[model samples]
Target: MVFEKDPTSLYQIYPTTVAVIGARYGDELNFMAAAWHTLLSFNPPIFGVSISPKRYTHDLLMKSGEFTASFLGHGHAELVEKLGRTSGSKINKVLEYGLELLEPRVVKVPGIGNAVAVYECRVLESRSYGDHTFFVGRIVGLHYDPRAFDEVGRPAYDPVLYLGKDVYVKIDRSRTIEFDPEKFRK
Candidate 1:
């Protein structure tokens, strides 16, 4: 059975992994959970995150012009939930959450030490769209936890996905597919 509704109902296909956006403004540092992020390029390693103007990170980026995108393993769901609920404008999330941060190799912003993977980025440009703004950043460096990968250099961590309304889920790796499009092409 199939049906249609307002475009806003498109959230039905969600349960996506949210990226923890990390940035620093002078001595200030903050982290927020964001589900609207994507890789825009590979060669130069461009990445983008949709941020609401009301978010504190937006102002941090506007001044610092740099940030880090981090993906935490499913084990850190508590941290993710806490980040999403708190406002950086009110308190320091890193200290409030007791999150251990790693020193950035290429940028001033520090990434979550618990993140399975992290991308350090420099803002290339940003544009307004409705109530949210899209920040496009060029990745300058990346780091990852080796435990997150397997013998074949493939991700082994159970993916952490946010299902909105405070729900969270993890991908069952047992059903994971190793598909090869070129070999199966008809």
Candidate 2:
């Protein structure tokens, strides 16, 4: 068997739709569109999301110690670009976009509605690295749209992919070949 412990280089990281929302203790609440997010653990249901040091949500997340990651679908492509291009500090993201907000069960931060799946998370650890800070969270609750599940019980989300530098694309499964280890890779 060709295997090694901690083979981090084997995986190719691609951009995904991530909506990060947090409330600032004294300042206004902020929601940022992020593409840098990953699941760090599963047993405790932990995740890590990165925010720029200068972002409004960054400070809010640090102060509140809670955040929500909302996975958007193809319909939310425009909203994603809008949130990423503009600053939450200047414009009210949720208000301007008419996004639905749901109160978290365990955390003070609100959740986004357009997301097909939402994860309410409480900050477990945080660290500053270079221009951005990574906040690791312990997932508190999970929600998904029942309609999105197929007959096989797999959650199917609409195409939502980012193409770097103000460009976004939707993934069409019909046009691409999905992973099949038996057919291609051994």
Candidate 3:
């Protein structure tokens, strides 16, 4: 077909799993919808989220040195977009939405009680890259809703994957395949 040359912020690597980051400074709690995040390390369970320094959640993150990553489901897309559209400094979004929160097991911050998966992390390192800052946190605690996994403990892939620009899709577990890794070995 045809080819085009463009080097813009085209978010080509989207359809990414969405998560709502939760942070608390003392008694004040905040949450933000994030599509850019990843598991930085498996051994230490380090997780990282890129945040613009201007965001109110970024301030809470630095002040508390702790945060929670809550995996969102398809049902939460509207709530996710609402949080992304406004600044937490303007209103208490948690109370505004009547979002349920969980008592964190290891950190002072809170986790979304209705989350399919949750990770409570304590900051290990933070570095700036352009307008955004990457904060690496060591996972201190983790949990997943029992219903999200199969009997053998394989996770049912039903996460809300953000396609960018306010679009999202939930992965279907029925399309799953249990591949044999050794069969493809070189």
Candidate 4:
């Protein structure tokens, strides 16, 4: 039997890779792990990250007009959790976590050096939706660890997937399969 409940319990989309959103404005820098991010477009390479106004990274992103989204492997789940739980206003997450910063080729903001992939983006627009502000950015530069992906661009490394409520998981590659969509078309 199917069960339904209030919309507030809508965290069904759990196994999503966490993207570490990094922002820098002048001398200030901060990083936050966000599961609420996605690739919005392919033509212009637009990406969106949702952040609450209360977050310090949100303020830096507004001032800088640029940011970096870094996707790390499953091995960094602990680091991701730490970054997401702590407030950047009260602590220097990068310095406290001992994360290495990587220089961006097109934006002022840097990315986590150990990231599997990083996208340097310039803010295209920002809109408030409920409690969070959705920032859309046009990707200007991309960095990736070639070994972490297959030739066709499929992830070869185990990505850190958030299971909500401070839980994390990784893909079981042993169960992975490749299929042709046309085979299912009747």
What is every candidate's alpha-carbon RMSD to the true fold? 3.0, 6.5, 3.2, 2.7
Across 53-138, the per-residue lDDT of candidate 2 in tens digits comes to 88888878877888888777877778777878778779987789887876677777767766777788989999998668999999
- Model 1 TM-score, all chains together: 0.90
Name model 4 segments beyond 4 Å from true: 1-8
Instruction: Please report the TM-score between candidate 3 and the true structure.
Output: 0.90
TM-score of each: 0.90, 0.81, 0.90, 0.94
The CA lDDT at 39 in model 1 is: 93
Candidate 4 residues 60-173, lDDT tens each? Answer: 999989999999999999999999999889999988999998989999999999999999999999999988999999999999999999999999899999998899987887
Candidate-wise lDDT, in order: 0.89, 0.75, 0.87, 0.93
Candidate 4 Cα deviation (angstroms), residue 150: 0.6
Across 52-120, the per-residue lDDT of candidate 1 in tens digits comes to: 989998899889999999998888988988998898999989778888987899999999998889999
Poorest 10 consecutive residues of model 3 by lDDT?
1-10
- TM-score for candidate 4, please give it: 0.94
Question: Who is ahead in TM-score, 2 or 3?
Answer: 3
Ranking by lDDT: 4, 1, 3, 2
Error of 1 at 181 (Å): 2.9
Error of 2 at 167 (Å): 1.4
**Greater-TM-score candidate between 3 and 4:** 4
Worst 10 residues of 1 by lDDT: 1-10
Model 1 has an lDDT value of: 0.89
